[model samples]
Target: MEPGNQTHVSDFLLMEVTDDPELKPLLFSLFLSMYMVTILGNLLIILAVSSDPHLHTPMYFFLCNLSLADICLSTTTVPKMLVNIQAQNQHISYTGCIAQVCFVLVFIGFESCLLAVMAYDRYVAICHPLRYTVIMTPWLCVLLILVLLLLSTGDALLHGLVLSQLSFCRDREIPHFFCELDQVIKLACSDTFIYTILIFFVVGLYGVVPLCGVIFSYTQIVSSVLRIPTVGGRYKAFSTCGSHLSVVSLFYGTGFGVYISSAVTDSSRKTAVASMMYIVVPQMMNPFIYSLRNRDMKGAFRKLISRITSL
Candidate 1:
């Protein structure tokens, strides 16, 4: 009768690459296109940032990190699913499955922390314009990124280590493609109370906590923008963070929606689709989000194009 009171099914049967046996061909082709776009789009962002010295800034630094994380995140799941689809066998070894779960969690954590850092960077740039350059110095950006790497390293390892102790026996089939964290935990032969508790804690720390930081940063930024004397100045100030803000909204909104979907619904198909929005779609969208919203990058691209043409 109620939502939280609803029982969670122990395991989900991964619907995998296709629902329709006949549509398998079409589905494979579509997913292949999406996966290619995700990898190529994200990789280009990394390349553009690395080769273009003028694009080196705290924003671009974090953008590059996000691109790399997206690449890793999508690669960990989609490729395996594609292989399974192509071969007509979607079963993953327990060990291979768990490894996928580990990396997905790690990369998700990595992206979460990176977005938090980027939010703070924008906050500093907008709220403290005079100190923006000094505050977000190249060394500081590097250190910030290094800190995220260390944070993700621990976050990913902890979940995997905890999951490693789990014994799977009742259900070997994992619902959805690749190894999802919740789906893997569901298969554990051991009591999942501790695992469930740990999931809540980690999700809160790695997911909800960063949401608060992003909100706080934007709140301060909005306050600073409101104080600007001219309309042009206020809009100009807000414009700087528009792309990142849109991306943040898209990412967290879709992510939390999946969590809610998995919570309320019992269907594996629904969960699989919801998961794709955050896990796969964002990988494809991240490069375009930055490219269209940020002006500096547009200028950098133009100059890059001009120089190459001259050569």
Candidate 2:
């Protein structure tokens, strides 16, 4: 059969995370558990932040959005994998695959942008405490979120449209559990030069820029904290940033690991496994990192739970 454009494509086969039939049940259970944890954990963060009037600041506002994004990002991938595992059918419809690609990009892009926003929030709170409320007004915060959503959705749609144009040969098996953009592109028989360029552009615009923002924000934060003179003051200021810093490290560290693994290793399976580190682990850990390290979050959660129990 001749290579056909995406229009003629009916579906693509998603490769299982593991090949062992014996391990299928284990893998299914494991992923299901993780998905549930990710959803519930992130939901709790949102509820805690929203329900508590004390938590209605810009930082917690962004935290709520971040939790929402994590929930979305995880939802974009995990549920399909669970369904495939249970059905013992790794086939994903072409439309479903394209939709997955679009959403994965959108949510991940939103997360990158949101993290940078959160970093700026910390910078304002620590470095310019007096003007923080003025600078990060409610309107400004909402505008930032709206702008990030536009940027994320626009980029995702562009990539999805470009991807839809590419033709594929008979080999339609994606080595990853879901329609990871890069993996899907690799299977295209058509020239992907434009798509490749767009990927790099989006990466720079969404990925590197946010990372730079986080770094700059933290740099100023450290400088301002150092000027506090008193050790307790310094410690207290730095503590506010600890949770965000941990999350930034986890997000970027695993992300870079995926890039490095994909670049250096010839094994697609290994690359897929590395992708899991970035995709699965951080979403599961973010709620814990924030709720445990953050006194406000812990108190909010307690209140939220008590309220729920009483209801």
Candidate 3:
């Protein structure tokens, strides 16, 4: 390998959704709108949770963090894609690509772990109602967020380091809108056997562990819900975690859809559409899901809007 070839490529050409001149404006407008909505929606959730005294509980705290993570996750890729579409340029610089990878990993990791943490919080609230306050202390919540940050940061750094070491071939065109880790890895001309195995290990460790935690938490919750004497009691208990569960399903469902669809079909465009659902759709839907399904969130937002209107 030549020493010059070993250096990171100056930029990578991102896959455009469509090549039609007429469609460029449509795509740009659509993505820009979605990005704006994602940002505004998640920000509102954070504000509502922060401003409302009643929403200062462990559940809402976790929710606020999740909203922040959603904002970061969308911001990581959508804005850049929108910019590229508007500018008629798909070239993302090497440094920018690496930054996108890091931020995306951190935000997604935060979301996954945060969802699991929220599940445990719900379990305690429903199952161990008496000790919910004591168990989910303010310090504990902060500590949990800190741990999530540390873990996400570590994982992202490891991924970035591994990716930086991988040399790309002459074809630096990534088959997706964003600098997706897997797609970038696939573009590597150099041997990626070890890195591939490492990624699988990391994916399993992060994906399985949190998913298992969520499953276990829900199992306990269901057991407790079933033991409730009244149907209304069960309903109330189930509703407490309903929003989180819905968000979790959307997140994982789209994620798996992207993975499975990419594997089954060789159509990069189809895969990119699926990836949009994975990366963009859930973030857009999360605020709506939480606010609509969770009465507390609705009340908080209602109050927030009323106060802003009065001002």
Candidate 4:
């Protein structure tokens, strides 16, 4: 059947995280709490960066963008899942599902690129302290962000457009809470060779290439740090990167876990569970990781809170 003829399709059924009726409320509360925390934490990070003149550097600028991306990424999936759980109806409109896929791709791609950019920022700050201010100008930072946004949006729209062309089986059951790209692709009744090729190209370009850039940036950072003669200088240099390193590890680790789980196991439920680590946990944890590890972020948060309370 041609995809054009399938315009009558109204919705797709999203599988719940569990079949046990008793666990629904618990799952709902858990996810709700996590979602709230993710939002609040990331928001505070943004507010702190904006409010504090001390955080007006390239690192915090990138951090602010990362926080925004985390909020967006979490918002893209969690609320819809929460809505489904609350309504006890796992049905998502066809349009909503496609929109979710597009936003997820955009935010995910943007976040990946932002992390790589952050690593480069750190590399410059540490390896070329004398040139840091001159090199990372405000215009360059803004341009990098604009370029990343454009690329991510373009990639996501391309995928969404291709997805709209594929016919789906009558059994439009997506085996995950959200309309995961791979699961949605599995539902297509038409040939998905082109889609598969596109996925590989995107993963290679957005995923592998950024990861390599991060690795390269950190390599230079490490080499420069090692050459520092004093232990205190080394600690200070490494400290600057600790928060970003932790985030990168969590992001990639959980992301890799999702891929491995999906590959090794036939259980869709397990795959969904693994995805929570990637999609939910990191956003929730990022604020804590930055604030706790970095003195500057901690001070910024305190100052922001003091101002808020004074009002």
Candidate 5:
């Protein structure tokens, strides 16, 4: 639509996963369940790590932050979706969409950076075991986390600012469940070339760089693991990293799948499903992957549960 022909829109209609009236109840129930599980599972991870002295290492400290970010990530989109579904109103206000964009960016960036930091922690633990403690000092951990938070906040605000400059039409309908940055930009009446450039830059910087760091860290970790002589020792070494590797794979795999699906197909419904797999599934799965696979997390969670029950 031309800029002069566009009517200023205060709200946008979110695309529904299905137009079938019969599916609304099913969709609502399914999403609500997923959201609740994501919250509860990640919250338990935070509590387990915080309350257990044994889990007070740099790794679990990052895990706690990751859990918190997962909660935030799930929260940024799910509740609004649930509300819209229940109310049968797909409208999200202009200000609300902007807020959604900001929070999602912040939380996703947090997850991405935290994963990279976790990978680095694994690298130090495995590759330079003798100097691991000295290398990943508590101060350094805090500093890294602070830097991530600052960077994510700045990036989110910058995206939001750029997004606010776009002119949207009256029948503003987002092709996804939430006000995703890209989808919102696609609806703009004005030029989005600059916005596209910003996205590419952000993806390269925030997404690709951290992901490459993870791959590099794991490469070192694998080499170090391979050098261990005994099978038992090698198993033990790999076991330590198993949970983290799983979470990282799930996070990036689903994320990449979403991007690929979006790019390959014109089906918004399929893209929305892929987005859910990216955002909701990983958050819901992280706690389970860690708690079930890692002995430390399991022990901590059991103690946490037992303590709660006793109280």
Candidate 6:
């Protein structure tokens, strides 16, 4: 197997990023629309958090971070997909492929950690109201986000380095839409056992660990909410968590469903469709989920509109 050299790899064919040739125009329009909404929705959340003095709190602080992460997450994949589909050029250079995978890893991994942080933030705010201010101080929130960023960056760099070691001989056509690590590694002609094992550990670290954190935090939150004597108090606590829980459930549900379907099912078509639900579909759904369900954000948005009209 030849090592990764400039002499080889004129280009890599990306198979069926969009299947139906006649439908390509429709898909391009649809994805382009979704991309626009994803950007605008996330940006509005960031702006609402920043501009609203009423939202100058730890909860909103963490929410803005989530919005930023989602923006990065969606942009890392969708825009590239759009460009590839539009230009009919899916051949990313070696450097570009690595860079894309690195970001895809960073944002998705960071989001997993960020969700845990946000869960803990909700727990502290609800369970220990008196100590919420002390527990989730502004510095502490920033510290958590910074930690997520550092860890995610390191993780992505590791993935890129590991992938670089594998020799992409003869077959370079990726089956999936984006430069997914799993799909790319499958294309490697060299022995990829070490890389495969490394992926298992990394998946566990980035997926399971953060999921555990979210579970533990929510468990404590439920316990605290259960202790609330008044119906109104219970309702209020649950309401605060409702939007977050919905988003979390949607994110994890679609993602886990894809994994399970892909693993157990024999059909590649089924797996591919599931992948779109988890990855492609979520970019549009996230903003809608948050905006429609989150009252604070909706109110903040209304305030924004009013302010704009006043201008």
Predicted structure with the largest lDDT when compared to the true one: 4
Per-candidate TM-score against the hidden true structure: 0.91, 0.97, 0.97, 0.97, 0.96, 0.93
State each model's CA lDDT, in order: 0.81, 0.91, 0.90, 0.92, 0.90, 0.81
RMSD of 5: 1.5
Per-residue lDDT of 59-99 in model 5, one digit per residue for the tens?
Answer: 99999899999999999999999888888899999999999
Number of the candidate with higher lDDT, 1 or 4: 4
CA RMSD per model (angstroms): 4.8, 1.5, 2.0, 2.1, 1.5, 2.4
lDDT score, candidate 2? 0.91
Q: What is the alpha-carbon lDDT for the whole of candidate 4?
A: 0.92
Instruction: Give the alpha carbon lDDT tens digit for every residue of 130-225 in model 6.
Output: 998888888988888888899999999988988777677676777667777787777777788877898899999999998899899999999999
Candidate 6, run of 10 with poorest lDDT = 1-10
| Model 1 alpha-carbon drift over 4 Å, by segment | 1-14, 305-311
Can you write out model 4's per-residue Cα lDDT over 58-89, one digit (the tens) per residue?
Answer: 89999999999999999999999998888889
Clashing pairs in 5: none
**Residue 238 miss distance in model 5 (angstroms):** 0.9
In model 5, which runs have C-alpha deviations exceeding 4 angstroms?
1-4
Which pairs of residues clash in candidate 4, taking residues 3 or more apart in a chain or in different chains? none
Error of 1 at 199 (Å): 1.1
In the range 82-133, model 1's lDDT, one tens digit per residue, is 7888888877765677678888888998888888889999999888889999
Off by over 4 Å in 6: 1-10
